[model samples]
Target chain A: MPMNEIWNRRLKKYQSMLLRYSKYILNDHFVLALLFFAGGLGLAYSNFVRNLPQKAFWWEQPILIIILFLLLHVGKLASLLEEADKIFLLPKDYQMKDYLKLALKHSTLVSCATQLICMLVLAPFILRGLQWSFGMWCTLLVVQCLLKLSCLTLVVTSAYDTNVKQFLQQFCFRLTLLIVLAVGLYLNLILSLLFSLILAVVTNYFFNKASQRHVFKWNDVVVYEKGRLMTLYRFINMFTDVPQIVGQTKRRKIFDFLLRSTSGNIYLFLYSRSFIRQSSFSGLFLRLLFLAGIIIFFSPNYLFSLLIACLFLYLIGIQLFGLYLTFEDNVFTHIYPIDESQQSFAFKKLLRKILLLAWIILNVIAVAKPLFKVEYLLIPVISLGEIYLITGIFLRNYIKKNT
Target chain B: MTLKINGLVGGYSRIPVLKDISFEVNSGQLVGLIGLNGAGKSTTINHIIGLLEPQKGNITIDDIKLKDNPKAYKGKLAYMPEMPVLYQELTLKEHLELTIMAYNLDPADTWKRANELLKTFRLDNKLDWFPANFSKGMRQKVMIVCAFMTKAQVYVIDEPFLGLDPLATRDLLNLVDTEKKRGAAILMSTHVLSTAQEYCDYFVLLHQGKIRAQGDLEELRSIFNDKQASLTDIYLGMTQDGHANE
Candidate 1:
């Protein structure tokens, strides 16, 4: 393929991947657009409100801003290509130098533009507030952008060697840039420009060296990339929702009590059995505990406590419902000679058991903690009631839809 | 005891993948389930093992209905899926240990059989290795060893030989033969009809969610006059009837 065609195809593939992977988090186009607009407004507000960097600590504000901006983008670009490095980019091992060149070119332009935008808009007000000369500030701004780009090049190029090392280096580089900008502020303009030139030369040297270092081996990179993606995927899978892998892990022998033979309903036993094996549900349970803990520590009034409790109940209901939806697609259930009505009943009973367990635990904690007012006992009671009501309605609709 | 099914209609969800599926496996009989891709062979076996619910009918193995007593019913049968289903966290020995615990097998017997299976499959060196590290063939061997170690009354295996090397496949086939001689009923699904022809005592041909034909090799061949055909030939002949006309 022609180089232009390959680059186009690569860009399309990356765009599609980003879109698909962001689906669970983004939900809809309107939400995405709103989020972007909100983010822009938030940034503008923060910049306007903060009155820019106002310290007399011998450092130019514009230079500091440029340094911080560049460092942030460097880290992002490094992590972004980390996945590509694992699967497609690093695999053509012989031509990695060429790929690194492309990556560096992309990262430099992106980092420079982002830093320039932030510094140009935010710096003048801040520099003026700090009473710096415009001519000196302009010189520092240009030099700082170069410093930022250089630091980015150094950090991102070396990321292929080790993510941990690259991440730490990016952080360390920010600190170094701050020190350099401080020195430039104290030194004469001639000395600052000379120092900036030296720093640029040194960064270029490291970037070239790091780019040639083909450190990501094939299988290792693939596994690392998979692990990284799965972490992000698992997080997104928690919110909105995705089909979580319902893998069964042998629980501790103590929890084996739950698996004990119950002569009552065979379907109930199976349903409970499957529910306990839903690994991600444990995370939701932990989230509830943390949320409850925060409410205990932080909520000031009874109404605040009640609202948080209601939110907790909503989480509980959704987790329980999600478990059913997930296991409903379970291949084992499909293959097993279970009765439809029996399976549905078992699922409901299992949900009730889990909900009851959560209710008991949360109520015990809430009532015992004196941080809660006597009226706060009403929170757990009301929360459980809300959960039961919501789950009951959802279950009725879900069953009707399935049937 | 024999596993008997009068009319087994089942599949994934309400979508019926196995329609009016019925089969019986007496103790000591080796039954091969043959089908092309998407032929409902796995669906049928899954229903028999009690992993799937029957949409319209019932299945009984060893005189115990899966719906009536899943725990007891599941204890009597061991299932091996097409892919080696394993916990990456568990070592090979731990996989066997968990299966033994699930089935409530005698500890001594479990250990002895697991060791023997490892030796037989030439995987004794890998007892401590996590399944995540195993190759595709090795993983299949682990699944085979775990199933055979259970020593269940019935074995329902789907495409058991997909990634197995020739030696491992031979060992698996021989293990199946030995299990049959010991009066254990076996239901195996595979697209490799030639291997099934050689090893299976009876054949069940599934096509498009229905049982197209089933019988002994000679009986299956008898469907076509004076044709002493192989099992694959008969299966192909039966499946092609409509296609040939079209």
Candidate 2:
């Protein structure tokens, strides 16, 4: 019942969940690969910057400043109130003000940290382009923190007013404030500080007015919290299994033809339909495949492109393994008289056909592009090997472990 | 056909929730599984459907043990869960089609029966509609249609009348009657004692994971020492007696 105890409990729960997934995300191989990628990009960026002319371009400072101002809008208030809290904590609703105060503090602090990091990242660009005084830079940081606080307040107040018209009105108001700050900063430091103070007062007024007018919309808060958690879970899902996230489905009738041809075996029909209709697995597959194709199309090295293609194929395979557990809780699946092994066979068959299609698409793209010519024939050959290895061996082990 | 459960003992974990439960559903018999919350009705059904392995017992459908030949045993029976468990992706027609394929039912005959069931349930116009769009009653109706279409030797339905409309409930009872006339065995669990007493040929009263009493209406009334007691009266009397014993 102590508000701080509840806050600490939620914080610890979320922290541990994030830590658990972060361990998987920060795996040695992945971290090293990321470092190499970042290092390569950094080198390219530094070379580009060094080769630049002495005078700063007219648009560079405005563009970077606008981007920094826009970044402040991305922060959300994490209330951490779950759907069940509506029923359980409804009696103690008045006491929730203290809880929400803590939530706001937590959200503001977290947003401030992100905003600081963004400023840090943009520091070199700002210094290179604007040539501002250190005191001015310090003033800019202060204005950004105040702007971020306003944005967070706006996000919280907006949750109370779920009407689309009111939401857009609030959004435009915030946008106007952002633009004012950006333009004021461009013109003079004193004007920007004055604009920030006005924005802070406006934000406080809006927050107070909204809180007084509306009792907390439990559904809106729960939905906002769920959406935030789902986004985190989705990101973590890429690195490791996160069972908390519920997948969505889409009726992709265009791909229904692929399933239509397969009949008689219910497992085949089920798996195929699930693969095409379930948005999470199919969406992940398509996104990864599209990314691979883009990367392959751009990369001048044919072998490296093929490697990227194979890597995506492996990712698709691993990701689709989640589909195996799709019907785990559906008792009808367990009640069905079909042989259990048939499910694995059907899943592998579906994967094989999908991977083959991806391989064909990638091969066609690779051949069509004139980036690298001689090793074009090798694309299919390598892809076929990777596909077989992934589907035949890796998938077999994955199914073994998951099942 | 007879669905026989003998000396069944099982629960979610090591602690047994159903203890030494025994029952049988013979051909043309509709056996109602009556129980309160936490009375092991679902666990008993789970064990019968092979979702939970009994700690010590055998469930045989028409002399075929589930462990001995799972496919054949499972094929012989159809199960409708308390809550409708449907695929979000599959449409009504596709659900029926998939059930047909899984049960290896004759396509033409089963499809005809499915169409009739769909029409009876007023879902004929929503063949292409997915379960996501179906209401609670409609979802339950879909499960009913799928199960009825299977035409298995035994049907194990749990709480079938929960969300059904009166018309759908009557239609379901009619369908069960038809199936019963065709010599299929049914073991249904329900809290609707009036409907159960009206339709069920026999009743198994479960209390605290054990069958406290089981018989037809007249027999149950006699057991409770009341010659003209309704099913509700018998049930209440049995439970109060259980409380007194406790």
Candidate 3:
């Protein structure tokens, strides 16, 4: 079992899995919407940058560099260790260091690519704000690579000693690196390069020492890997059904009142209760509602607000359709004597109520603003129409296609 | 009323696992469906419960076919599966209420019976509790209560003793006997040979997707020509002989 071989195999496996799911996630509609969003933001950003003041402030450059460094800190080292590895690979524990080192290298490479992309996205801002030479930008990339490696090493160290003291130490170390890099990049590139070299040496020393002193905490590693995998699965679940993702539920006793009044139909009872209790559906509903409320509150015109509200209602309706399949595999559902049409009817009824509730809240928010005018009354009228269309026509088409 | 399976040939996929399996349970009869793992006991139950459609057969409860009238067919039978299928969101009381609603049972009578059944199963205190935190045995008890709460003509129970404690198992057996006395037909599948032998009025020994033998204890013993054999002995002999023949 060579270490690089294991790393390559695991990397390929995860990459392929991610690619397979991402195809579903990055569909044409989503990509088009994303492109429109990015184009809008890009236009705004360029306009803002073009109208910038002539005087370049000292702190702005450092702050921007520090923000870029922080953005690069988003990823974790992909150990790619499954739960079963503990049993299957425990006999090879002594040789686990090579495997871990390979893991570190692979994680750093992946994170470096991510950081490069982020830097590229921010390159215009960096170039315009600081007036830095291209060579200096290259130097910054090198320093970023160093900082990313240090962060990766610290992640490994924290896995070994996940205590308050280790956390504080890592926090202070990262803060120090941020400040040193910021000051060095601002004052002198040579100094920053020298300091980053020292930091890299120190990071490697600690990484090697920790690796030697501590055996692999298989539980922590497995949990970390599972968390990483679940994050991807959860994201993919938002777009399409990820069969591997298990939904979480919350008690949410505050919402129990909504279920106190039942329709005497079991499907209605079940679907309504599931909507309030299951976090997957309920969380999406609340999140979309919150976003809709915010957009409706801040919209410049009544038409825009109405459009935003209706769009969110449509999204909520579409996303909440996943709830219909929640109990598909349960045998009791098949054995229940309820009419087949009752399930669809109950689901539509539940969604209509939920969408109406969202509509009411958004309308209230729209009306409560001090800028409310006579035309604002039409917001609710338009929202009502949208809700009916979404819950009736759109849901019918969705159910027809899915069933 | 009788729950009859004329010729159930079905499985999870296109390939048939149950090969023309046939059985019947008349009113007040408890017929034990016994088999080894992957011996088509679950497939047979799945077909009868209408989860898996039969490729070449028909199942009828009191002359109501599942395909023709699923509502009527499902209304007559209550199933307690091996693994308890419970809603994580619904409380124990809500589960009973939902079952009553699904079956259209009389609220007053069903609620009274439900309360007594909950008390008998020692789940009265947990009426408002959801199944999220329940132990395996407690979940099984919940399913048991829900199934028995609906006074259907036929009870299609699959491996009801898997996760039950001794007291719960005893209570379940008592409930089944009570249901039998109330003139309901029960088709129960179990690996607990002694319990099945003692409680079942008739036994259907399934081996490899086919019925090896089906009869009362005396008939089973006579079929194997073992006058002194117990139900377990007869079952063992049948399965071993099945292997020998294969």
Candidate 4:
């Protein structure tokens, strides 16, 4: 059994899974909402960029270096190793270097593409804000791609050498990356490009030597692979149910006081505790709220702010409808002595309160923007009305369809 | 004060798993529903707990059917499932709270009972932690505490001794004994023939969805015509004789 066949089969299956979930991710409504969000941000960004003084702000180069450096650390090594491989592939340990070489090559291709696209997006600011030459911008792109290659090498190196010091792999590697990126933006592009080239070469060479020196760290590698897979699954989970990812529970003891005030209604107690303690539910609510808050905070005009706020309210309400079925499989829910209709009513009450909180936060941001006017009072009035629609009709339809 | 299942035919799907099952667990009686794996013990229990609707016949508690009055029927029953079904986001204490809230028990009163049971199981100190993350035995203890704390008239417990330690198992049996004295009707299913032989007032030996033999220990031995046979031997004998007849 050649490992190449194994890698190809896994990559194919992995890709198809993503492709299947991508349809749900980019549904028309979500895409439209994302476009509106991006358009609003773009307007604000261009406005800010146009108004920039002829001289760069003192923090401009440092901020650019930080952004690009963080982007360099975006993608991880996708080993695709499963827990069963420890036993089944144990006899093939000698060939693991070849298998990992394939993994490294695949990761480099994906990550370099990511670096290239991000550099393209940041190209405008690099060109105008920093006033760099086209040649220097191209050099920075090359340096980003090279640095990303180095990042993958560092990750792969840790797989072969479990005893690799955290200081060496994590801190020093990141410190060197920051320094190189800072030098590239602040001092000279060619020198920084030269440094990253050497860094990438050294790390890849170290990977080969370590692979020869050490046995395959099967447990560590499998755990690393699972971590990477879970990260992907967690992201996709934001859009739809990913069975591979389980929602984790946190104690959240500080919110215990909130429970004291809640009545002893079965669904009310269950839903509130579920929302606050499960990372998936509360994380979704907060992530959407934060995104919408930022969008509305920079909303170019009153009408756009109103549009964005209402759109996000609807999105958050729909996403949270999943909470209703959280206890669907629990035997106690079916066996409990509570009235059946109370479940829906309690769910609606919680949903209304949550959306209304979003409404206040968003409307405050929209109205509190720099160009406030009395006429903008209509925004709050209309959004107050939007909350009722989302919590009432929108939620009703969502619940009806899902159930 | 009686739990009755008469001609109860049901399963997860249209095809019935429990066929013509009839039994009565009257007040103060501990009925051991003994069975092998896949012997429809759980299906029968699911029917009793109102999780599965009847395909043909009816299940009633004191002449009150689940379909006729679900709240009143369920309010009188407490179920401890084989696999612990816990709220992932709930703490150990919150599980008690949820139970009390769902059952409409006075929290002030149930909490006192819950603390004593929790102490008996050595789970009193785990109140603030999430029981969903507990060890298997610990989770089973949490389930026991919740079910017994409910103090309902009818207790339906399934395979409660699987993961419990000797001490916890003894504590559980003692709790069941006390509940029986207090007039709770318990219908427990288990493969632990030894314990069931001693504690259960009556036995309903289920084999392949049908009651093969049901009696007290002496009666079960007499049915097999072996006066000295243990419950395990009697059960194995009954199931084997069933296969021979088939």
The native-contact fractions of the candidates, in order shown, are 0.11, 0.89, 0.89, 0.91
lDDT of 4 by residue, B123-161 (tens): 889888999888999999999999999999999999999
Model 3 regions lying over 4 Å from their true place:
A1-6, A57-66, A92-95, A158-174, A177-207, A210-215, A286-312, A358-384, B12-15, B55-57, B106-130, B133-135
For model 4 chain B, where is the 10-residue window of minimal lDDT? B14-23
- For model 3, residues A58-143, the per-residue Cα lDDT tens digits are 77776786686677567888889889989998887667777877888888988888888877877776677777777888888777
lDDT of 4 by residue, A44-157 (tens): 788887877777889999899889888987899999899999999999888888788888899999998998888887877878888888999889988888999898888877
Residue A279 error for model 1, in Å? 8.2
All candidates in order of DockQ, best leading: 2, 4, 3, 1
Task: Give per-residue CA lDDT, model 2, range A128-220, as digits (tens).
Answer: 556666777778877888778877777676656434487677768767666766665568877887787788788778776766655777787
> Which prediction has more favorable lDDT, 1 or 3?
3
**Candidate scoring better on TM-score of 2 and 4:** 2
Which candidate's TM-score is highest?
A: 2
* Local lDDT at A328 for model 2: 84
- Candidate 4: CAPRI quality band: medium
User: If candidate 4 were superposed on the true structure by all CA atoms, what would the RMSD be?
Assistant: 2.8
lDDT of 1 by residue, A137-216 (tens): 67766666677667656644554564446567767777766667666665565566667678778877775665567664
Task: Flag regions of model 4 displaced more than 4 Å.
Answer: A43-61, A81-99, A127-139, A182-191, A209-234, A241-246, A370-372, B242-246
Task: Pick out the ten consecutive residues of candidate 3 chain A with the lowest summed lDDT.
Answer: A28-37
- Give me the candidate number with maximum DockQ: 2
- Residue A118 of model 1 has an lDDT of 65
> Using Cα atoms with residue i matched to residue i, what is each candidate's TM-score against the true structure?
0.65, 0.93, 0.87, 0.92
